[model samples]
Target: MQRVIVRSSRGALPTAAKLVAGIGLALTGFFTASAILPYLPAGTRDQGAGLMSMSFGWLIGWRVIGRAPQATMAGAARVGLRAALWLALTVLLYLGALQMMARMLRGRYHGLSEALTDVIAQGLGLGAAAVQLDVIAMLFLGGVLSAILSAWAARRWQ
Candidate 1:
């Protein structure tokens, strides 16, 4: 015989772990975006970029990392690293697509396909410009800190 466990809507209620993780990663995203700003080419304008990144980070932390099964401290660290990479990639893709759209609006691209393809190029260029030694160090440290906090919250609250 086998037993099945079912979860209800009530199970979806927010927990301390989720709140802690979400806020921790959200701060990380905001700081990372701020770090990237100075590296952007002069006259390159961005609106609400920090807010966008923070939202993504919160989503990933709350929905992804928070919901992930608890494990050993080492495993929690891995989850944090994974979340960091996801945040970085998601932000990169978003920025790329945004730049592509801006260029299209200016009639810089000829065709739709060409404009879409340039999204990757634009993202890569931004990554290249933004990824300095200090930025890399901050990102690495921030990810680790967020992970530790989330794991601690899980253990303490559970």
Candidate 2:
């Protein structure tokens, strides 16, 4: 079984570029969602869901690389780590852009406390523990979506 897995991964070597492109495409999707969704109706955006989706997509990319023909478990792990790094970079860039936009449009954010409160509200809502569960569930759903896509890409590209 292990040998079979190894052989399958080995066959996926030529698709590295494809994998990278897919990740890029996924990130583009995430940014697009983030930029446009916030402007919609109050309940429509669901920032927690968006975050979850991105996280899932990132994991999908990792799994795709892992299942590639030439990839070993270690290689797959590395791919996952790299994907995570890229995800972090993407988040930082997005947040920075948001801050810059906010500064230009509004002069300043009211303060850190206000920002924190807003974040908490978005993630945890007004209800007690229910909001937290919703956020977690949304995030999990996002991850599942990402993993499915990544795995599909890997299989298709191979």
Model 1 segments beyond 4 Å from truth? Answer: 1-11
Each prediction's RMSD over C-alphas, in Å, is 3.9, 11.1
lDDT of 1: 0.80
RMSD of 1: 3.9
Instruction: Give the alpha carbon lDDT tens digit for every residue of 41-64 in model 1.
Output: 765545677999899989888876
What overall lDDT goes with each candidate model? Answer: 0.80, 0.44
How would you encode candidate 2's per-residue C-alpha lDDT over 1-158 as one tens digit per residue? Answer: 35544345443544543455346435643653455343333433243534643664444454443344223434444454455444434443444344444444564556766654454343333122222433334333443334444454555665
Q: TM-scores of all models?
A: 0.87, 0.35
Off by over 4 Å in 2: 1-70, 108-157
Residue-pair clashes per candidate: 0, 15
Best prediction by lDDT? 1
Model 2 TM-score, 2 decimals: 0.35
Backbone clashes in model 1: 0
